[model samples]
Target: MSRVKFELPADDLTRATAFYREVFGWETQRLPFEYVLVDTDGEPVDPADADGGISPRTRFVQGPVLIIEVPDVDEVAGKVAAAGGELLNAKERVGEYGFSQYVKDSEGTVLCLWQSIADGTAAV
Candidate 1:
């Protein structure tokens, strides 16, 4: 299994975090520097079995952004572009927080690539 996950980037981590906390009532865990983790509870989901009990109506779970834990942001950036995706931003340090970049998928939908330098782990 691939350790992939999705992350929603913000121009201002503090402000975005606060806005989400108040508006969505989400729990935020401050990591090193300005990086923070939005706490969420994951539950089993099956679109085909919507009538089953695993649905949200039956099992209440926190459905957050689908974060893909990638390996190399730089390499993936190339793959993304070559695969019909466009690089919106080059890989750069996220201040003292970590490293991040942006890209637009084939459909022109922008997304973020997250990398945690502290632990040497990455996500995109």
Candidate 2:
């Protein structure tokens, strides 16, 4: 089954991580490029949990975006326009681990699709 994750933008990493820690009991770890990974379930973070990254608020993402894992980024992306959604950008490599792309649904909700490196298909 496909896994779903959420990505949220934060203005402050230190404060944001601290708030999530204190309020939701979620644990967070700092990542390279000033991103933070939040473990909403309190589980020890796995090495491949890059989808949970909380990045600084940016022009493309001023709010929360859902990250859905798929088997193939290009295949799903090809259906966006026909489904009445707009492809925000083409898929780009995420550290040799996966590819990520942004899209906007018919209802205007922005989302990110992630295709992870296959272990024949890795667990989320």
Candidate 3:
């Protein structure tokens, strides 16, 4: 699609933000509710094309799980299972913005699947 955003889990927001900023030179914004937004200053690239020293083979489970936009969370979740992957949880509403679900591929790399809900209604 056009854009993709990644969500990283951190126990210490301050420390994590500082680490990214100091180590990688990424600009970070401390948002409300202890959420620190990291600006990578570049579009999301495929692991295969990334040259930040992370091997593409382990990139899926190494750090931040990639968030890919999809049209239907449920449909993609079903496809994931059919393709030998496992869903970590059922699709759920994302604060009226969309629905999301965590899934692990056959290689055990967890990623998030997101589907936007245009009408603000929960999608079945």
Candidate 4:
């Protein structure tokens, strides 16, 4: 089955991080490019267990996104387009992590596709 990863939009990283940290006791890690990673607990998410990561809102990401992990981003993207969905952004490499892309399903809901690297350290 395809894995589902949830993403919440954050307009203010500092404020959002603090809120989650205080309210939920979640730990936050600031990645390069001003993106903040939120862990529900202090422990790092096991690659085999994680559903997704939290980050700041981007131009292509206006609201919450559900990232679905796949084996091949390009193939899935083509399938999305062929199924009457539209690609919101081209596939992008997240450093050594993996490749990802955004798409709007037939219902106009924005979703993300994540393809992990060989090391399995990719972010969704």
TM-score of each: 0.53, 0.85, 0.65, 0.83
Task: Name the better of 2 and 3 by lDDT.
Answer: 2
lDDT of 1 by residue, 72-117 (tens): 6787788889999988766877554456676777986665565555
lDDT of 1 at 74: 83
Clashing residue pairs found in predicted model 1: 4-68, 4-69, 5-67, 5-68, 5-69, 6-66, 6-67, 6-68
Full candidate order by lDDT, most accurate first: 2, 4, 3, 1
**Best TM-score among the predictions, by candidate number:** 2
In model 2, pairs of residues that clash are: none
Model 3 compared with the native: what TM-score?
Answer: 0.65
How many clashes does each candidate structure show, in the order listed? Answer: 8, 0, 0, 0
Model 2 TM-score (2 dp): 0.85
Q: Which residue pairs does candidate 3 place in steric collision? A: none
Model 4: residues >4 Å from true position, as ranges? 45-50, 120-124
Runs off by more than 4 Å, candidate 3? 1-4, 29-34, 42-62, 118-124
What are the runs in model 1 whose C-alpha is more than 4 Å off?
A: 1-25, 29-36, 41-67, 120-124
Q: lDDT score, residue 112, model 3?
A: 80
